[model samples]
Target: MSSGMQRYTRRTLAREILLILAGLGWLFPLYLLLLTSLKPDSQIFSAPTDLPTSLDVGNYAEAWSSADLGRALFNSMVITGGSVALLIVVGSLSAYTIARRPGRWSAVFYLLFVVGIIVPSQLGLIPLYSMMRSLGLVGSYVGIILLYGGLWIPMAVFLYTGFIRAMPKDYEEAALIDGATPFRTFWRVIFPQLRSVTATVATLCGILVWNDFFTPLIFLSGTDKVPLPLAIYEFVGSVATRWNLVFAGILVALLPVLILFVVAQRQLMRGFSGGIKS
Candidate 1:
């Protein structure tokens, strides 16, 4: 018994050591970013990984003003929020229909949405751009929001469908039996039970939309309403990139998404775990 206990304890210690190493590896880049952002231009290349002797915040202020981050922050927030909201409403409704209905057409539609998940958005970029340009939506907030919605709604629907399929139909049936219409039942009875998956969708979609640079770059070019990523890109010049300011801009851009993940992490886990099993 003593030998077995010692072996188990040794294994646990080794596992913990490995985990700590992995965690440090993951955090090393973040540490470097923060450290680099604090150093002056002269100190950056000389001591890239060294801890900053002083907590200089000038880089942050300069990056913010130089990048015009305030307007970019608002643009990103609105676009991300609007896209997630659109996904939740449309994706949930579509998934509910697919899950509850039993027909060849329903299966076909579900298959199409699954195919959408597998297909890359870049495939149709040219045609999509042309269409948006023709519709005069190329530089508009509503256009970008709608574009993100179209790109990500498939993922949202896929998640919702799986969760809803696993769910017992009792609540929905009960609501319908109580004279509630299908739409009303979904809103009142089913959606409340979908809080976990909703968080998952919101977090996943929000992160994607928030960090996406290519779509906004193409669609929102020559416009003042660029997102955070584009604003950060301003620090990257062809001749000389300002490492300190670039790091500061990147750190600033990351804060909102980091806060979002921290807040919704529990729900994200629950959603990934398939929520309440019926």
Candidate 2:
């Protein structure tokens, strides 16, 4: 092999090694969490650093029952699923309109959304809570769904708009010439092209909604309505600073997202790459 090629190969190997080490560094805590969750409570305190000598699945059973984690998981799924669905539909429609029409007022409308992104959600939490209360939606599933959807809109819209704008106009123009109505053209022709961006948006929004604690904590009053994150918070509180149970609950809570990432990782990477290419 040429000297230059040999040097390039060595650099590539070094980079891969560095990346592997970094990935393991990030996963170290999660590995510890998983081990702790499988350990008996007695073993948790006694052999904190050591793996369980005997496998015990009882801790998972205990954790699941101790905090209505099952219900919390269900609630989390509903909220995150609803939020992603709404964001995709509404955000895509809004993006298509902005990209195709570009009316005199389009810039103003887009600017408003851009400004919304800059405004922190915490700044409006108090007023938002009062509004939800007045609407008689406190502790309701609809309430949380709407809040999550609304809060995520700005960023979702921004991504959709950029993706839509990058699409070629010829496709829509040809559909128009072929007697397809505007709505039909958008739905059938252009919308399918948006799959990559939509996937990226869904993955991002799912992660955010799944892990969110503040919204559920503040808006949900009943135990049954709380999502996994807030349920885990309650779990920790009940344990009175028992790190074992806390870590166990956190591991349980993280499992869904980890599974999601593992399943959708390829699609997620492709979507991001496609978006950047466009």
Candidate 3:
């Protein structure tokens, strides 16, 4: 082989080795988590780093029943699903309007949303809690759904607006010329083209909502409406010394989000590539 080809092959081999090492490094913690979870308390401390001799599936059952994970899982699904759906609808419409309109008002509104993304949600936490409590929204599914929707809509709008602005207006114009109403044009012609961005928004916001602990803890604490994160948290606290059970609870909590990412990974990649290309 030529010297240049030999050099190229060596470089590629070195890069592959480095990537493999990095991937293993990242996965080490998860490996530990799985190993520890499969171990009993007696083995967890003694052979902490060793692989399990036998699978301890009881840890999962114990953790699930103790944490009431079934209910928490249901609650998480409701909140995450509801919030993402609301965000897609409102955020897309808002972004579409802003992108299609050319005026100072549109710029101002977009700027406000940008600012919203920058601002910390904690700043208004106390006031928000007080208001929700007064309205008897505290500890309710509707309350948490609305809060998450409002909090995440700004991010969704920012993403959607950028993608929409980069998209061509020909489809929308053609729809309008064909006697379609603005709403119909947006839903039928424009929205269909925004699948990538919508998927991006949904996946991003869905993960955040599903994993969020603080908001649910604040609003839904001491209630049966707690989501997976909070439920896992409470479970951990109760079983603090039992690392095996704690890990089992955590693993259970992680499954749904992991499954979601696995399912949406292709769309997620397309969305990211579309955003960059735009």
Q: What are the TM-scores, per candidate, against the unseen true structure? A: 0.94, 0.92, 0.94
* 141-249 per-residue lDDT for model 2 (tens digits): 8888888888988877777787787878898899999999999999999989988788888998899999998888889846487898999888877877456667777
**RMSD in order of candidates:** 2.0, 1.9, 1.7
In angstroms, give how far residue 179 of model 2 lies from its true place: 3.1
TM-score: which is higher, 2 or 3? 3
User: How many clashing pairs per prediction, in order?
Assistant: 0, 0, 0
Candidate 1 wrongly placed segments (more than 4 Å): 2-8, 275-278
Q: Which stretch of 10 consecutive residues in model 2 shows the poorest summed lDDT?
A: 269-278
TM-score, cand. 2: 0.92
Candidate 1 residue pairs that clash = none
- Candidate 2 Cα deviation (angstroms), residue 246: 3.2
